[model samples]
Structure formats: C-alpha cells, structure tokens
Target: MKETFEQLGKKGLIDILVVIDDSGSMTEEQKNLSTKMNSLLTSLKDTNWQIGIVTTTVQASDKCILTLVKSTDTDAEAKFAKAVQAGLSGSGNEEGIRQAVNGLKCSQSPWVRADSSVAVLIVSDEDNCSSRGADCPNSPGKTISYLTNYIEQTLAREIGKTAGIYGIFSPTVNSCKTAGNIGYQYEELMTYAAQKSGTTVSKIFGNICDADYSNTLNAISSNIALLLKNQFELSSAPDSGSLKLSVEGSVIPAANYKFSGKTITFNAGKEPANGKVLTAEYNVGAVPLFTKVTLKNTPAADTISVKVGSTVLAASAYTVSGNEITFKTQPASLAKIAVDYRVAAALKNAFQLEKTPIAGSLKVLVDGKAASGMTYDAAANQVVLNPAPLDGLAIELNYNYRTGPQLSYQVAIVQGAKNVKLYDGAKELSYT
Candidate 1:
C-alpha cells in the first residue's frame, strides 16, 4: 500500500525549471521576477515539485550556470530558498536561452526517472549574449535556431515519447533591436523554441505584481492538471460490457449512469418508448431584469404580455417561426429604460458617475422630442432617457459634463429600439 501510494504521488509530480535573466536591464525587472517567483513558489509548495534556477548576463565567467536545489530534501530546500531570497541579481556571461535549455536537459538525466515530466518557466527580456569578440555575431537567429533544435531533440530523447514545455517572456525586451537588444532577440528565440519544442509561450507586460500573474500561473497549473488527468485516463483499461454515449441536447432521459474503470454505462427504467420527439424548452430567464429582451424567435402579430413580478409592465408581440423571435416594439419600463439606451459601455458602467449631480426630476430629449421620466446622475456620469408611452423611440443626453483625455463613455440603444442614433456630444458616435 505504501509503494502504491508512492507511485500515485509520483505520477502527480511536476518538475519545473525557472530560468531568469540577470542581465543589466533585468535589475529593474527583478522586482517583477521576485513577485512572480514568490507567488508561484507559494502556490506550488503543497505539490510534489522541484525548481531549478539559471541566470544570464555578460559578467560571469561561465555562460550557462545551473543552481540546482534538491526540492525533496530539507537542507537543499533551505539552500534554494536562500538563493531565491537573494533574488535576480546574480550575473552571468551568456543569454538565458542556452542556460535555460541546459538546465531543463540536466533535470532529465537517467537518474531522474523516465516517467518524470519536465516543464520550463523562462522569465527573461530574451536578450542573447553580447560578449564583444570578433567571432561573436550580432544576429541571434542562428543561436535561437540551435537552442530550439537542441530543446526539441533533448525532450524527444529524454523525458518521454511526448513531452510538454511552457515559457513566459517579460516585456523588458520584446523587439529584435533596441537599447536592450537582448529583449527582442530573447522573445523571438523563445517563440521559435517554444514552437519547435511543443511549448506554450506567454508574454507578460505592464504590472507583473498584479493579480494577473497569479491568475496566469493558476491557469498554467490547471492545464498541467488536465494533462495529468489525460495520462490517468490513458493508463486505465476500458470495461468490456459498457457502452458510453454523450448527449448535447437539453432533454436527457432519466437513467442510471455509472462509470467503472474506462467505461460508462446507462441503465434506463421500464418506460414505454414514445415515438414523439422528446423536447425541453428552457426560458432564458427574466431577460436580465433591466435589459432589453431580443428573442431569437420573435412572436407573431399577436403580442405577448411580459410581466415583472405581479406587475404587467409592457406587452410587445413578435413573429415566431421555428427558432427565431423578432419583436416589434422594444420592451421598456421606468426601471428598465437606462439599460436600453447605454451602448458600448459595460453593464457595470451603468453605476458610474460624473462630478456634478443630476437630481430626481431629470428630463431627456431625442432629436428635439420630449422624453419623460428620464433618470440622470451627473456625479456618476450616467443618464437614462426614454420616451413616454413606449413606441420604439430614441433618447439622447444634452447635459454639460467635463471630459478628459482618459475618460471614456458609451451609449447603447435597447435591443429592438428602431432607427436609434447615439451621439457623443454632437459627434454621432453610433446608430442602432
């Protein structure tokens, strides 16, 4: 039982290498690196994992140096913890590509076990080596090509018949030529390398300290979990006496479904087989409270009364043939009018406000027509105008508010509001 548990645990282990750029420009990038590493380390600590670190710069004697830490042991973990605490300041003599590839290769030795899968996490500006020498070429394409080929060949030979790789590129160097030339070359090289090695490459820019980094790492972990799940499925045998079926329709028969090993079986109750097509109609739910309801299948000339709670708000009919519902007049109420007019803005923006406040008895006009019971709030920068006795009319805002370079606003017409044209000030932004 102990051996079996160990085997199960071993199958779930994820061996990862973290290759970071320690070049001159990477000094500023170190903050982001530290944050990302800490978050990743914290999240991955509970799992059976190992991490190796490598750095790249032009100052070190060795171009590719590996800082291996035995993750399974306490002493090694402490040592590695110290190294990571030292952060991304260590310098190296080469671009990170070679070192990262070599580090991953080192992890795949025969002693490491053939069943262990390897993944690489590259945090670099992607700058190649810039050692000033007559033999050193300015172009990084050749170096990149060699690294890509080497990684592909190594993974194919060592880890498994099928192996996966993942990479993350920092925004410090994205272009091929710049003040920091390594960034661009690094990106290009890694992109090609990832493609050749069947790896997933992600480019990170802006604030690396944000929750987005954690989210991205979580997504990668989820993907790794999926891969492990697939492996488990492949190792299991299919049950001989079971038939598995997948249904996509809304209606499903009431049956007992069982899964034994790799086979799924469905046992049905004793019910007479009716020749009629089994149908299930699901109401898409209350048309989103204050939002317009554009039915895919419109009703006929005979209108249908739509109610909110016990109050019969408005009755608008549509012509429905097959799966399409085209309504004549867009549905609108005092409470739901704002949702029908705001276009291009997110649903959450309905609550946004400008500086000045528009009081309770606010009014609206569309193309010189009076619209009643309109709601306006200048403090939140929001306005809702709807013509009374709803007849598919357009509403416009003619209020004074300060505009800034970064401030953005959107206006949207209700789903079925006909001949509606929304304008930003006098500029006619959109028509629906």
Candidate 2:
C-alpha cells in the first residue's frame, strides 16, 4: 500500500475544530485569543486540512447555546478570517466547553466525516455551565456526566480512533482555582470531563508573546506530525555523515559541508593544512614532520606547496603514505617556519607555523661598567634596567653572534620614561 491516506484516497481527511469561549470571563484577553486563532488558521491554510469554528454564549434563559460554523466551502478561509476579526462577544453564561462539545456533537458537515482525523481545540478561562439551573430541569453534576459520557461513547468511539481533543486554559482560571474561588468548581468539573474524554490539556498564563505562540504552535504541529507519520508508517530520513579536516596538529572542524551523491564539499572557512604550524607534535613515521592528522577532503594529487610568510620554501610532490605526507626542505630560520599544503579539488589552501628555538644570552652594562649582579634569559625575550647608586647611569644589552655582522639591534627601554629612549655610544634617540 502506498500510504494510509493514499490507500484510502479521497476517503481520508484531516479535520480540525476550534471551540472558542466567548463568555464574559474571556473579555480581558480577547486580543490574545484573536491573535492565537489567526496564527493557527494561517498555518493550516497551506496544508490539505479542513477547519471549523464554534462559539459559546450564555442566554437570558440561563442556558448554554452552542453555535457551529462550517469551514469547508470555497469561502471557508475568508469566513474564518472575518470571524476572527469580528471577535467573540457574549455575556451571562460561563460554560464555554459545554456549548463547544454540544455543537461539535451536533455538527453534520461533510468535513466531520467518521474516517477523517478530527482534532477539537478548546480555549477557555471559566468553568461554570449555563445549563445547570433548576428551571432547566437538570442537575449540574448529572448534566456534566451526560456530556462527558456522550463524548466518550459516541463522538470518541466513532472518531476517536483518528481524533484528538486538546484544551488551552487561560492562567486566570488556574489562579482562581488555586485561590479557592468559585471558579474552582468549574475548573474541577472541566478537569473531570477532559480526563473522561481522553483529551490533552494545557495552560497559557502569560502575555501573548511571540515565544509563547511559536512554542505552542510547534507543540501542536509536532503532535500532528507524529500522528500522520504513525498512520502512514513512513520510512526514516537519511543521515548526513560528519566531514573531517585539519592543519598540522591542530584540527579545524569541517565547514559549509554539502553532500551530493557521495560527493561532499567543504566550502566555508579556511581549508585545513593551508597555514604554517607555529607548534606541533613531531612525527617519526614515514612522514617525519607530523603524524596522526586527518582531513575530510583528500587532495587530488600527492603534491603541495609549503610556504612561510610570503616565501615558498619548497614545492615538492608527495604521496599520502598511511595518511602522512613527507616533504624535504633546507633548514633556515626555524623561528617562523610555516607549513602549507594543497588538497584535491580544493579552492583554497591550509597552513600552520612552528616556533623557533631561542639562542644567545643578554649582557648588562650600567654606567660603562659590567653589572655583575644583573641577569637575563633569551627565552624571556626581554631585559630589565636596574639603576645603581651611581648617578647619570647608562644601561645597555650587548651580545655577539658569529653568523652576522655586529650591527646594533633595537632595544626597547620600558622604564618611567616618556618615550623609548635609545642610546648608541653618545647618540640618544627617543620617540614620544
């Protein structure tokens, strides 16, 4: 069978009935009701769904009147739109659910078919029924029982197999019940009826905020989706695997990943292994540079360009032997060594930097004399100037290397001076 709905074809339908409480008790938050109703109707219009509306009112006769509005014609959407605009207006009675359920039970429209999936949504705040007066010739308890039994035995039995009933109670009703107010009687009564009918109930107790609307609507849609999926026995959707890429020892999570028939692309962010490595775990495997590194997009060829700053140190061809690439290069300044690589079919490249080893010691000169008590380390990359008891003291750092000429290297003096005061024999240079 194709699907439950498809197998049954036109015989299957999804009917949603909205029962709104128009009694005086709902006057304070009529705006919220209208907003919620409009949002729900808008979401249902784009789908193959049918909806109906019913309003509850109290009469001078002290009885609950149920008014049903059929929403299945060419003008159904427009009519719902207009009804939501006109708003719900009523007074005298407080039993919205009683009228709603009665009207639903009596509705004879084609959209309310026996096989159609039916969902009745009730919105209310008060709990008393207008149908419970001595002149009405019915006790409140007995009348409520009759209504609950009617729903569970008749409507529920015929449509409950594919039908769902939901209730949204305003916060005012909850507060009243908790405060031991007269409204508590109605709250308890409705709770019983709902429990007996196997209906889902929720409470809305804050301002009509966007978050509240989105969350409530999402919950309703989730329930409907689950119901549809279960009835159709659909297959699970496909899963997308994770993309992997890295630079030297540091890894960059895959970016802008897309899959098309076994072909995947990492389009966003920098590609792994495009930059030089400033620090990394040394490798001793077939590739004696770095090891255990992984990448999602394999390079098209075994060759890649290794660069440091703007200078390309090596352009060699290599092969992925056990997921490692080996290259040869002449050792130069190890301070700023950058590693770069070109991957297969990749638009951009990846790189990393490696730290250089420090060499040489710093010699201190205070007032043209060897300051024997002063000491410094090259790894700290800085020198401290300490003034002695002598006045007019001159401090300097002297170091010699056999690889280069004895040209003066700029030394920064970070004392209580307004500028970086420089001194070369008798020449003094300072920058503010």
Candidate 3:
C-alpha cells in the first residue's frame, strides 16, 4: 500500500495578534516585545505577514495593536517599529484575547487579510484568569476552551485549521518564580493555549520573566516561518540516499528540496506549485533516525510527538498523518518505543482507543477491580474499553516495564538508620 501524504493548506499569508500581560511587572517584558518586534520578521520570508499587538488585559481605551506591516510593505521595518508596543495597564487578560480578536477583526486597519492563516502570540509572566463559569464566581472571566474555540473556530474558522498560538508565559511546569513577580493559577490556561490544537502538539513556550527574548523570538520566528512555508511531513521514513520526491508527477530538483529527518523541506521560492500531487517512496528501515506508525486523529488520541526514555522530542521528531505515525529519527534497535501522553478528560465512556499495537497492554484497575471491560482490537490496533474508566483514575500502562513519567515523591517508612524501603504503588524493588 502506498503511503498517503496529507497536505495542509498554504499559510503563506498569516495575520498575527500578540496578546501580552500589562500589569506592573510586565513593563520590562513589554519593552522587549516592542523593541524586538522587528527581529521576528527576519525568518518569515516569502510570507504575507501582517503583525498586530494587544495586551492580555483590556484597558480603558480599548487598546489593541493594529496591523503594522505586510511582508510586501515598503519601509516595513519603520511601520512595524511604529505600531508595536507593550502597554503596562491591561486589566482584563482572561477575556482580553476574546476582546482583541473581535476588536481586530472589526477594525478598519488593513491588518487581518482575508482567508489568511492566523497566529495568537501571548506573552505573560503570570497565570491567566479564564474562568468560563467553571467553579469560579463573581468575575467575568473566560474559559481557556472558550478562548481557544473562538481562536480556532470563530476567529480563524475560515482558515480550515487552528491558528498557531505562540506564547511566552510563566512556566507552568516545574514553575520558577523570580522574587516579587509571580502568578498563581495560570498554568492550566497556558497549557491549554499550547495544546489548543487538541494535540499535545509542540508550540512556543518562553519564560515571561526572562530578561532576554532573543531566544524566544528566534524560536517563535522559526516556527512561524515553517508554518508559512507549507512544509509537509513524509508519511514514512525513507533512506536519505534512495528517496525520490515528486510534485505534479515530476521529480523535483535536488537543489529545490532538503530533508530534515522525515520532513522534506523545500527552500523558499522552490516550493511545489499549488494543486500538485506530493508523494514519496521509502524503505521503512534504512538507517532510521525515527519510527513511523499510523494513529487515530481524534482529540482523545495521544497523537503528539512522544518521549522515548528521558528524551522529550519535539513534534518535528514525529510525522503524524491522518492515522499513521512516523519518526524523524530511529531509536536503538533494542530500545523500547513508548510514549506517555495525555488525553482529554472528557473522552466518552466505553470509547475505543486507537494507536494500534501499543508498546504495552492496558493494566488499569477501575473501582478496585482488575479492568476486564477493556479489550484490544488487533486489526484496528485499538483498545475497546466499554464504560470508560471513571474520572480521576490514573490509568497507566506498563509496556515492557520501561520507566515512565514519575508521578511524585513519596515518603517511605524508616525501619532503621540505613534501612528504608521505596515503593511504586505496591511494587517494592529493594531496601537498603
């Protein structure tokens, strides 16, 4: 069977909205964004880029950044320099993004081009206040989902894909707080923003408290450039030496294309013309740098680039098509390929799980009973667990007994000065 390539629509023209937090601590951060705004455009070549700015908090004057410059604009450098600024008085960041989207779309400024790809760049040092009426009361806060829905569905719905969210926020994972500047409950929303595309997909994450945004800007700019260039992943890995790429049935010139693991990136100005049929043929295991497998493309699917052992590879390390998985590099032949991923908490009960031939089988106990309701479909490579496991149950698989993510630190009872026992759940390895 031929490997089918899924081509995404060209995002050559993109409209970007930058939403920043404007509280007192943000004075310095906003200046970095304003002064370094032009640095982001360097990587976005051959792209119809329109830039705008907005604060995460809504202010008294409805301050939203207007379109600064298009890729084709003359003296675009000066225009961008003139329009981008990080204000220090925003107060409604939770619903601020929603407001900005509406405001930008309705503005008379020629910033948002018709039918263009969209990107929401959020920069903040504290957590967001998106409540969306979930448990929190007495405040007009929007839920992360509500904001994501608007960004993906309402704001850029016509683009046929979710707008890219590039964020430089306080670290929600293993958070690091510097001195008096801090946040309390924004990790969930920051995570939601990164995972808004419904995949554990990799997006930009920068420390909002950092003094230098040079690295963040570089990473974000590179990501945007790739998105705008319409880079596509090969359905499977091929030997770099034997690979043949065809566009419109004609083999493309070697100079026109380059290979980064499994993704064949075309140089700017050398992209395959539109309506062209892109295809590649490869030997599955030829000096492989990554592995490939098909997976279910559902919101519940653990369909993002996976971690093998201690390495957390980026999404670029995996080429996931409609329902298959491919890796950018191959692991050791003896090494087990396992990924610990997260699924949406709202998955349907008794739902069948896809991603066939998983590295391990399901070994979860529901309600204190060995889970017997779960069955695997070999043909479909899915798990049929009827009456989905109850919420809040930690369902983990022990495929090949590889060390997965550590849940937490547990205290062990000390029998003597040198005799302490460590345990994982009920399994004790040793005592010394």
Candidate 4:
C-alpha cells in the first residue's frame, strides 16, 4: 500500500541547538566539528535556520556558548565554528540531554521559534550517564526512554513543533579509544527522533571517532531541507534507491524530489499542485550490507545488543539464530557491526595466597571437596592445581603463615663439618 503525506503549515523554520562536550578529551573532536560545521550551514542555506550553542553542563549561566546565529547572518559560519570550538575545560561527565533540555528552558535567549522544527546536535564522546564522574542530578534519568521523553514531551511539546536529535559520538555497543563511552543512549534517541520525524538514522547521527564531519553534516542538512519543504512522512523507512515517487499517476523524476529514510521532499519549485495526490511505492527495509553475522559465542537474549555503525538497530531489526544473527537489512560494508552479549567468565584455577604459607599448611578444596594433586610453590607463594576444575566450580584455599617482618641470612661453610656450628656474634651455638 502506498503512503501519503500532507504538507504542514510551518515552512523551512528550524532551530538547531548544538550541545558540545567540553571535557579535556574532546579537544580534537571540537576542532573537527568547528572545521566541518560549514558543510551543515551550506546545506541549510535555503531554510530559515538559526543555531544555538551550549555546553553539556548543569550550570545555566555558563551554558550558552553562542546565543543566536540566523541563516541570513553574514558570518554565521564563523560564529558557529567559534562557538562549537567549546574549550576542553567543562565537565567530563557530559549530560548532553540534560543540557539540551536546559537550553530549551532558557527564557533569556528567545532563540527557539514556536513554529520552527527542533534538531539537537549532541557532540560528545560519552553516554548520558556522564560515566566519567559528572553528576546530572537535574536530569530525570540516564536512560534512553527518559532522554527521549525529555526531547519530545519536555522540549518539542513545549514549542509545539516537530523535533529530532543528532549526534557525533561513538557508534558502537562499546566505547572506542577516542570516545569515553559509546553514545548508545544518544543514538537510541536519534533513531527514535528520526523514525518519528520522517528522517533517517544516518541523517541524525555522526561518529565522534571520524576525522571529518562532511558527510554527516550533509545528511543533517538534507533532513533539515526535508523539514523545510513540503514533504511526506512515510509509514516505514524505505530503501531510498527502491523508492518511486508519483503525483496523480505521473512519475516524478529523481531530480525533482529527495527521498530520505522515511520522508520525501519535492525540490523548491517542483512541488505538486495543492490538490494533487502524491503517492509513493518503495520496498521497505534498510539497505543490506551483510545479511548474517556469526557471533563468537552464544549470547543471552537479555544481554544481546546489536549496532550497525553508530546506529543502534531496534530489536525488531534482526533475529537471533543459534549463536548467529541475521539482519533483515544488512549493515553498511565499511561500517562496524558490533554485537554485544554476556558469556560465562573464564574458569580460574590459580589463586594467590594472602601470605606465604608454612611449608605444609596449605590445603586446597574444589567445590567443597578436598582437591588432590594440588601443589604449592613457596617461592611464588601461590596454589596451583595440576588438573583444573570444571567451569563454574568454586575453589577454596586454606593456609596458615606468619604475617610479620621476614628476615634471612647468608652464611658460608668451611670444607667439611661434622656438625654445623652457628654463632650470634659473641655467643656460639653448637649442633650435634
């Protein structure tokens, strides 16, 4: 069945709040963002876009980095770059969502337009948890659901406009070297915002580890354009290449429109007449990269989390088959596909003693049973089991040893001695 879209009254009005992490580790990332921000500006040139910058900190006074930069401003690009180059002196615990909500709460700036669509660009290498040690006590919670609600109900509803979230952070289940932690929650919110606002995941998220932001900025720009122009929100995200756009039984040329993940926008002058019915037919599914991925070990259902690049796929996106998972739509070729799950910890057989044991006082027990063939090497002061116990077996060691200062003496013995004689300086002791 073809899905239809009705044009909204608001046109091309977008307020982008860029929330940056100013932690010490974010130095290079900030520079990269500054250098590549122009790409986003160039893409949104046709829209009435305004940019606001804020650091991810609870202190409201110190939050606003750039108050306002409208699309028509002569030096908007430079202003945005300078603002995004938020110095690396802010909190390491980046509560990006909390800062975003606070930004929306700012009454002094008056930058957010009531009718404008909202897009929050979260530039951080950490999760909302502020894992590094910053406390976001003002936030409702550190979960994706709470953050999503803050973005939609608290921010978007307050402005009475459609909203979306974008990110430049780790795009995996686990953190990479550059990022403090994976942007799992931010990414989840990005997917939620994209699906709700008729945009694609790619358009709403970027990788912090990447050296350039050109492509990500372009995607964001295209999505903003979709919001600015008369567009239709598709019921399902479609493979852009397979999408077909038609108006009143007339096929629209590819150049006449742009198909984002779940939305289609007609170029400025190419919009169909008001009364015409626009119809779209497209196969629905993310483009395939690799249909199947084999996991190294069996994964618990509750612990399984899969990510294709920086986009965290919904649980419905893939199905688990044994230890292997098959995605309904494959991931991008170059993009990293990470599958995280819980496995049993490796069995441990050797254990260190708290103190050196008396020559024969050490005893070993495995699973409450006396263990045999166990030996203790005093030099190493550890207990070693010749045959290790099975996985999940508990091991217990019992030993008694002196715990005070230890001393040793070196002495040389003359040629042949019937009985060694020891002396303590003035007093001599004889052994028979």
Which regions of candidate 3 fall more than 4 Å away from where they truly are? 1-11, 59-67, 78-83, 92-95, 107-110, 130-141, 156-162, 174-176, 179-190, 193-203, 229-432
Model 3 C-alpha lDDT per residue in residues 147-256, reported as the tens digit of each score: 56665666654222435666666664545475122333344544554454443423465777677887778776766664564555555667656777776578777788
For each candidate in the order shown, give its overall lDDT on alpha carbons: 0.43, 0.43, 0.57, 0.72
Model 1 over residues 1-432: C-alpha lDDT tens digits?
000111122133456666666655554445544545434544344345566766654323333345665546667655554444434455534455556566655543422223344555655544455422112364242265544555456554322222334444434433323233334445555455345445454521222223245555555554444223111111233333222322333333435444344322223332112332222122222333223445434333334444444555433444444334344654443343211122222222132344444234344565467655556655556765432323333554444444455244465558887777655799886532
Better of 1 and 2 by TM-score: 1
For each candidate in turn, the TM-score is: 0.39, 0.37, 0.44, 0.48
lDDT of 4 by residue, 18-86 (tens): 888888888888898887766776556545678888887657453443457787788977888888887
Residue 303, model 2, lDDT = 46
Q: Which candidate leads the pack in TM-score? A: 4
lDDT of 2 by residue, 21-42 (tens): 6654554344454545434544
Clashes of each: 33, 21, 23, 2
List ranges where model 4 is wrong by over 4 Å: 1-11, 60-66, 132-138, 145-147, 154-161, 173-175, 198-200, 229-432
Model 4 compared with the native: what TM-score? 0.48
lDDT of 1: 0.43
Model 1 CA RMSD to the hidden true structure, in angstroms: 29.0
- The number of the candidate with the highest lDDT is 4
TM-score of 1: 0.39
